[model samples]
Target chain A: MRPFLFSKSSAINQALAKKNGTTQYIAGGTNLVDLMKKHIAEPESLVDITSALPAKIEVTAKGIQIGAMVRNTPLANDAIILAKYPLIAKAVLAGASPQIRNMASTGGNLLQRTRCPYFYDVTTPCNKRKAGSGCSAIPGENRMSAIVGYSDQCIAVHPSDLCVALAALDASVKVQDKSGKTQSIAFTDFHRLPGTTPERDNNLPANALIHSIEINENAFAKNCAYVKVRDRDSYAFALVSVAAALNLKDNQIVEARLASGGVAHKPWRWLEAEQYLKGKTANAATFEAAADIAIKDLRAQSHNGFKIPMLKGAIETALQQCLNR
Target chain B: MKQEYNFSRRFFLKTSSALGALAFIPKGVKAFYEEVKNFIVPKKEQLPLTVSINKKSYAIKADTRTTLLDLLREDLNLTGAKKGCDHGQCGACTVHIDGERALSCLTLAAMVPGKEVTTIEGLANGDKLHPMQEAFIECDGFQCGYCTPGQIMSAVACVKEGHTKSVAEIKEFMSGNLCRCGAYNGIVESIQKVAAK
Candidate 1:
């Protein structure tokens, strides 16, 4: 734990520029605080960027453009977001407690890490932490671990409920770099852990700051939602979850964009599942077929073997709700 | 099946507030906090600040490490905002900043210089209590009264934000403030009572 200076910046690029690889920009501090307490994030300098980012939420022609600093409560209550993108609103509301969502930012929520208990306790050997360190969750308490995105190197789950919904919605993340250059990364690639190196969560450099996130206008997404199964009722991470967007034609599934969580290193887009449902009735058989195809490659841990069933049930329920709606 | 941590913290606040006043964690919590503190000893800095609280402007110099909760209780000698958990997980230390209910535990004192702050003490006009505060008392909205200030602050904001439509909406909006006394049924009743007027 090194003692470092704390800097306040209202400019995202300037705050990122202050990063010497040992500094992290504080957005809402919701994720960072837990990591800091667990000794996982030991950055000496914290650049407070909340003041610099405009906390704006507006219905743009493209979709909803949520500022980096916009709190979840307002987003959950935003009349437009609630009406037009109820999935986003529901996802935002599903995260943790009200205190967490209040202090949580749009950018930070998208960047939140997996809640694998092994990932937090520094003593546990984790591939996501020290490269090549064997995954402790392989044989440890991994009931909440990933069943999709399973590989020899890493298999921890993604934590963001909102990100999964955004992934299905094809959301874009706006970023500003130290050089004041701006870029946008689509939600599919916004978070990555193809594991060969698990430490690099996103494609963004340490000197790049997230600005805002834009959820694309997908008619199917407007009718979507994020549903989670967790150990507890409140303030707990997901055990298995699904973010689903579906459009039906004459009571038959015409289009579907389903992404699953608590089952992957990132929001695992069930494209095979969605493709299977094309021109099919959104009944139990169709859902079961998609769920079966979605987890075909999964090889979970001894404790997390249940995730296969949990994630499958989650997708089935989410898709059914979409069909019912 | 996952072990049930089914006990909701919101339910805890709905029923109890004062009688169950103790640290939420086990005895191991002290050691856990100390270990975390060893990792988070922020390099301290100093700054001068002036801010109005409960109608009086408090002029003071503060270390950047001081949180709004610390400033209120330690600096201004206003101990109404209890510090149940300094980590922003609990809403024990809540105050109104420019009419918006905010967590004082997570708020930096230095960032509040220009804001008009209001604590539980300011909710009364002369000898008259604010309608929400009076309703809370009348409905026995609190058990221990420890989370009363934060609950009152959130209740005031709930009405102001027009979250009085349904019990679920009010619960969703007011979820930020945790009441360990579980006096939430009465708390909601109190808010419903004042919102009726």
Candidate 2:
């Protein structure tokens, strides 16, 4: 890795002011350091913002506010998260290893780049790494590439389990700019679809820093499950994962929020499927119908065509688990 | 916003003089530019880091890119924490940072300035081995013994965190530390033995 300047900032304004296009903010350094070592990310300066950001897990009147610097381990093991947002906790636990979870931060996880092999291999041409360089994953091995919301420029999927649950929970991201102007972005809109510019992952501006994530209190606590189907039982990325939460009243689904991972550039929310499940009986037939609607518009690549069936199975299983709970 | 400046005679004279001086002494100008760059931008050459390891405080100068695992093994000669993957995938580089298990390979040395690090070398009380270490030996928790240190460290933490309620729980908690020799049975037994006490 190339040598870079490192500064430890204790204030948000100081960190934001120091950041330019070539500067990156480091927190946890689990992914950033690894990417740096691979020469994938060569920032001229690194601003240490771990201590600069708030680390609190505050329970506000609207809902829960998770600080950006909160580690994945604590967030997964937090009592309130386990009770109120069990899907988030389960998703967090399913990602990475225990040691990694202890070091990864909430904000860093949201901004993590793709795990596509072509993207990591600097020898290969990747549009995500270099704009208009042409994508190698398109014609090469792309079993893990996106099945929806993909462009010819890039097909890499966002490898995050936590964000999938957050999307289902209808979370919002709070970002603060250098001028101290703050704005809340809906979770569904936080990550961008890989249209023409796959180089830009999210809608976050270069100067703005993520402050915290706000999640409103929902009634899907008792009926929520995060099911990640990977090649292994643990410590693996999802091949097809489902985060299902259904609010049932008198054996009828009053509301449903379903999102999928390992399928798109952003968390793939099946709004149509969610809308179809409303007022339906909690049974296998209803779940199968919802699953069909979820995968209806999906267009998979050559190698990842199996994901359509796998996604259907995962959605069915996750809904069944939620209904059983 | 600051006002943008247009080209002027004063700016041209200032630039021409700087170029003329550099033309007269090209080597000297290059050296001066490097000196100014170094003075302005902080390089990774000599970063002052203060960390407490095994209850011993050490003030050392490290490169900004040096990982905690490299700082311990290369700088401090603490080779007990092996670097199996060095990418945070394998648990062989697991160490305690402020009593919590973390991957030293992924952690930068500069990030551990105010935190306490506990490696495999600090697990015992002089000649006496830590209870988890002893349990590993008694249960034959390792075959090749490469991943033993990390397994023991994670086992100790798993028991301490009260996650060793059953064999399944131990397996789940210790899933991060992989043993290629398939010594998982003995490893789980060792954790169970320590948890039983």
Candidate 3:
């Protein structure tokens, strides 16, 4: 790792004031430090913002607000999350190891880079690592590449489990700039499709710090499930995951939110499928049809054609599990 | 001429002796030379940090880039935490920060000033071993022992966090600490033993 200066601040405004092109912010240091060690990231200086941001999980009149610095472990085990927003808790627990969850921050989890092999290797050609370098995953080992919302430049899928749940929950991210000005960005709009600029993972403006995540109270909390299919039963990245939330009335679906991971550049969701489920009876057949609509536009790579059926089954299963309880 | 000759001979003797003694200088003097060298070609950035570890405070000048794992093992000589996969993949460098398990290798030394860091070395009281340590020994929880310290630290946290209720729970919580020797059976048994108490 390269030698760099480290500074810490307890004030968000003061920390953001020092933000520049070469100075990166450090919180939890789970993903950033690993990237630094691999030479994938070489910032000239690191500003430790772990203490600068609020770490509390607050309940508001509209919904709940989770501070950016809140660690994953506490967020997963929080009483409110377990009782009311259980899907978020389940997704958090399904993602990483216990130690990682203890150290990873909510903001850092959203800002984490993709787990694409080429992006991490640094030697391989990856448009996400360095734009226009060419995407190796398109022609190389791409069993885990994105099957939807991908462009010719990049085929990497977003690797965040929590983001998928947040997408399903219609969560919004609140960001503050250096001047203390704040703005709320909807969760789906926050992460960007690879497009031509895979290097820019999200729509977050440079020098803006994520302050908190706002999740409004919803009826889908009780009937929600996050199903993750991975190589390992635990401590592994999802091969295809689904976060399914439904609002039901007398065996009929009143509303639905379905999002998938490991399928697209962002948390993959189809409004057409979500709209199709409304007023429909909650059963395996309806869910299978919804799953079919969700994968209608999916274009698979050479090795990831299996994901089409796998994701379809996962979607149906997630909705079925949500109906069980 | 004889006086001049004596002065020149004395100067030559002093210079020669100083040059010859450089090879056998003490370690402290050699370290000072290194400082002087760094002053000429400055590459390292140093910062003063006071960290509390195992209920003891240490004030040391650390390189700004030094991680907590490196500080404990390399600087402080507390080698219990093994540096397996310097990245966060392997849990061999697990330590407790404020009673929560964290990957020390990913934690920069600078981030730990105001926190309490407990490692495997601090798990015992006086000459008595911690119950987790005793349980590990009784159950033969390790073979190679490289990952034992980290596994023990995580197991202690797991039990405290109420995650040791079932065999599957123990296995899931302890999945971060990879034992390449496949000593998982005994490790799980050890956690169960301690949790049962």
The residue-level lDDT of candidate 2 at A127 comes to 92
List, residue by residue over B107-163, the lDDT tens digit for candidate 1: 767667777889998989999889998898889999988888888888898898788
Better of 1 and 3 by DockQ: 3
Steric clash pairs (candidate 3):
none
- Model 3 docking grade: medium
Q: Per-residue lDDT for B1-197 in model 2, tens only?
A: 99977989899999999999868887877899999998676466669988899989999999888999999999999999999988888899899999989999999898898898998999999899999999888999999999999998888889888988888778878889989999999999998888889
Q: In model 3, which runs have C-alpha deviations exceeding 4 angstroms? A: B1-43
Candidate 1 residue A186 Cα shift, in angstroms, is: 1.9
lDDT of each: 0.78, 0.91, 0.93
| TM-score for chain B of each model, two decimals | 0.76, 0.81, 0.79
lDDT of 3 at A36: 89
- Writing each residue's lDDT as its tens digit, candidate 2 over A1-325 gives 7788788999889899997888998998988998999999988888899899988899999999999999999999999998898999999998998788888999999999999998889999999988889999999999998999999899999999999999999999999999999999999999999899999899987779999999999999999999999988888899989999999899899999999899999998999999999999999999999999999988999899999999999999999999765
Pairs clashing within candidate 2:
none
Interface RMSD, model 2, angstroms:
1.9
Q: What are the models' TM-scores?
A: 0.82, 0.93, 0.91
Stretch of 10 with least lDDT, candidate 3 chain B:
B1-10
Tens-digit lDDT string for candidate 3 (A1-325): 7777788888999899889998899998999998988888888788999889999999999999999999999999999988889999999999889999999999999999999999999889999888889999989999998999899999999999999999999999999998899999999999999888999999888979999999999998779999999988889888899999999999899999999999998998868999999999999899999999999988999999999999999999999999875
